[model samples]
Target: MKNQTTTTSVTTGQMFRFVFGQVLNRRWLLGLNVLALTVISLLEFVIPQYEQYIIDHVIPRRDLGLLTEVVLGLLGTAIALGVLNYLSTYYMGIMSQGAITNLRTELYQYTLRLDTHFFESSKTGDLMVRLTSDISNLQSLISANMLSMIGSIVTFIFVWIYIFIINWQMAVAVTLTFPLMFLIYRVFRTRIHNAFRAARASQAQMSNQMQNTLTQIDLIKSYTNEDLEENRFGAYAQTNKQDMINATQNQAIFSPLIDFVNYLGVAIILALGAYFVIRRQLTVGQLVAYLSYVAMLQGPIRAFTQILNQLQQSLVSYGRVMDILALKPAITNAPNPVNFPAIKQGVTLDHVSFTYPDSDVSENGPVLPAVTDITFTIPFGKTTALVGHSGSGKTTLTRLIDRLYDIDSGTIGFDSVPIKDIRLSSLRKNIAIVSQDVYIIDGSIQDNILYGRENATDDEVWQVAQMADIADFIHSLPDGLATQVGERGVKLSGGQKQRLSIARALLKNAQIVILDEATASLDNESEKAIQHALENLMKARTSLVIAHRLSTIHSADQIIVMDDGHLVEQGTHESLLKANGAYAKLYNAQFS
Candidate 1:
């Protein structure tokens, strides 16, 4: 299968628009936040004016009453600033949280709908990182840093205009350094972004390694390869550590350089203001106020450097997230899809062919299709058995029947209805599969069984469990149906897990049943019991069974033998044995 990572590149402008678009979902909250920030910026500008007045007028005139009044005005402005800051923060919290929550949910829902091909080519750990860590990065950007960056811009604009009004020459002198700081940021921007991207990739690799190792810990222990696994994991961790340090180092260097340029701007303002004040071209009070304004102007410039760092990292995360969101599921319902009817004629395949989209190529040429030009019929209310060697396309045939993948050529029909024409949800709901590799969720026994039929009553659940011959096992457990099954049903034995799978499939009560080595995990006694249960489950249903054990299918209504992706033999078990063809060969080998 292809291992290429799916990625979508978006321009900086596009990224901002998308993130802000989510924030805009709560329009009123965003509007209120902007208003609060604007008032706070104006209040910040007003405070410097008060400082100028006190120094130039109140102190010189020695008017106690005027001083008291100006002080009261400053006090009131401070209170207003506090209130506005609180409201702004609160409003931003609501907007950012709501936006991130909605975006995260949308991403998850989209992922669930994606085709199996996408998942086969993707790592579970990397996908988890994108959904969780990457989303969290965006939340931080939107909630705290982004609004603060906006406020800084507003404050800078107000302060810049005021300083120019008080003294144009000083404003012009300090402004020269502004371009140099921007130049520094522009020069370092791509480098910082590249570093952050590398870090993010490294983190994904590390997460993938951790997930892989943890999931297969039992295998590692079986072979006593814990040290080997640990060493492998350590390598991933080391790479991640280095990449993060590299990103942090780039940010560290970038910020200080910007700060150095900002200090240069401050020095120019100081020298020019002092010269003007001494020469009587500017009042000391006006010079002080200009200095204060210059300080305010520097705030945004400094903030820009920090924001740039955050912007680079957030952009990396944004790209990762958008890459997933941009993907359109390969398998989607046709326009005005036909609702699947109850099965009567059963499934039919007419010269069907399928090649996995990501199938690996040999050095000489491309590999053969998984199933090639196959044709067969699964008649209603009958059990048809498929016997094949490993990789003989038996399981692939079952998946094709269920429309897990669309055939590359010809067609698969469900009760004479073209499978693709049927609504995907409706088609899948009517088919139930019990495969060799049973998957049991980490939940109570009842929860896992109910997954097959969520609305099934307690009595109905027990009935199916009894039919699957697992009711006695449940009764023996202290918690019975409520018994906790650890992650992947780790608490249960293989036989128990398989039995639960049978119970779940029995509960689904689907019109078509597929048993793909369903009894492989069961012991001799359990297998005998489950075979009886299977007889009941398959009765009056269109059933398809794939088994390596030839003995199990002796009573099947029809037996089909497959070899190297081709149907080689078909007949009743006795006829196939009498013919002594592929089915007889497999039967004799197993029996011998």
Candidate 2:
């Protein structure tokens, strides 16, 4: 989430550690693939020797019977190797899929473990790229030619040994070029790396822009700023285009640079080979075979750069994923936490202070700490309403109680036990919230309500729906409880959505309930309907409500008024108005 550049220059071996570890999970199958590749390499190596022998012995001697036998042997090896190739490729797919599936699943589960702050600063679209596109890149990187590279390595070593035995001078001539090739690669490597890094950055930026634009499509259309959005997206696309061009340029040059080195080696082999043949030290077939070796050598030579480029691209994705994995949640359950079944007394906050984390603090000019040295207690079975102007830390206080964010200082405890000493699941299960921003998943209305209590009965669901005044709406639909809510309840009006949320909370039946402006969007009639439901839902439960309309909470057991993150007054609404303080001012501003 921080704006610092990610570290991305790890060696290919280092980049492949995770992949190799994953491959080992299907080690036997992968081992078979390796074995098959080894056979293919050995058979291919034998074919060149057979070609040389047929030219030097069988053809010159005109032994049709020997030629027939030799040709048949070659055919048999090819057939066997072909079968092996099929098995290797088929099972390699199985291996790659298995590994990538596990990796993606682990990444998703790990992302879920991260606290609220991580999602707050991170982009959903960028994370999607890491999970989907980036994860996809890793497969080709490992499976594309790993087996071929292995085969090439085996063949290269064996071929070199054979060629050296036949004529070490020609072999030596070819060997000299390797160090020079490596040196050339060293020179171009950094430029290639930098180009890939730039391209990856551009890709991430483009993905982020596209994701944000699509998510806010409604806002763009509502404000008639579609052209503005289009221009912004085009800029990202153009930047990506330039990055791709730069990357392709570097990649395009590297292969030729390597090819040039390989050509130099071949040239030296050719010139020396002629001298050997003239001196009666070598035959033409041997020279041809040596040339064949040189040609075969190109497989690995080209593979090296090809593999390196794909790896660099994959590591760029890896670096993004590692960045998320590196974060340790700021909020987590204590190693030893209370296993209390329920809260015995009440919830209490003592001198708690909190400031939201920001990547660009300077731009915000120090957020001035949303909640500072504020303390309060909500007695069990009592409704405590928070009254304050917007941005006065009312919602922030409730968030702290839920332990969504840890406080900068001081303690909040439940039943004399610090909330931090309670398991996170235990803490959350006991608290239910109906926030102003209603989040309804795409599912049937009953399916949404069942989210409140995973195993709530059909009758219980209907009962809570009645309390929230949404049962009639559900029953009137053709499908009743099965009627779809669409994405975020897009089919429902604002008041309908609010009632559905209330129904979910009532069904949850948590001991500690926080209703932060739950009815803020409802009209007077809808508000009255929800108010009656709230009374039923709040019965004998500790409730913390933040009211947009002052009149809604006049009957609340206690009213706490806040200003600029400080608790300015606390008492009954009538008493606060009599005191002529912050609460009175807020109430009079709305009702006077």
Quantify all predictions' global Cα lDDT against the true fold: 0.86, 0.83
lDDT of 2 by residue, 1-592 (tens): 3532475345666668877788888889878888888888898887778888998899999999999999999899889888878887888888888988998898899989888877877767678877887888878755837757888899889888888899998888888887877777787777776777777777778888888887677899999998998898899889889888887888788878888888888889889999999998988888888898877776677677666677677877777767766777888878888754476678888999988877246674766888899888888888999989899999999889998898989999888788788899888988999977898989999888888998999999999999988898888999999999888788998888888888899998899889989888778888887787787788888999998898889889998888998888999978888899887777777765
Could you give candidate 1's per-residue lDDT for residues 1-592 as a string of tens digits? 2343744676778877888899887788777787778778889889888988999999999999999999999999999998888878877888888989998999999989988888988988899999999998888767755787677788998788877887888888899888898888888898888888888888898899889988898998899998898898889889888888887888889888888888888788779888988899988788778878888888887876777867888888898988887777768899989987788887888998898886779899878999888888888889899998999999999988888888899999988999899999988888889987989998999999999999999999999999888899999999999999999999988778887888898898889999999887677787776787788788788999998777888889898788999989988999999998988888899888
Compute the lDDT of residue 412 as modeled in candidate 1. Answer: 91
In candidate 2, how many Å is residue 215 off? 2.2
Give the TM-score comparing model 2 with the true structure, all chains together. 0.95
The numbered model that scores best in lDDT is 1
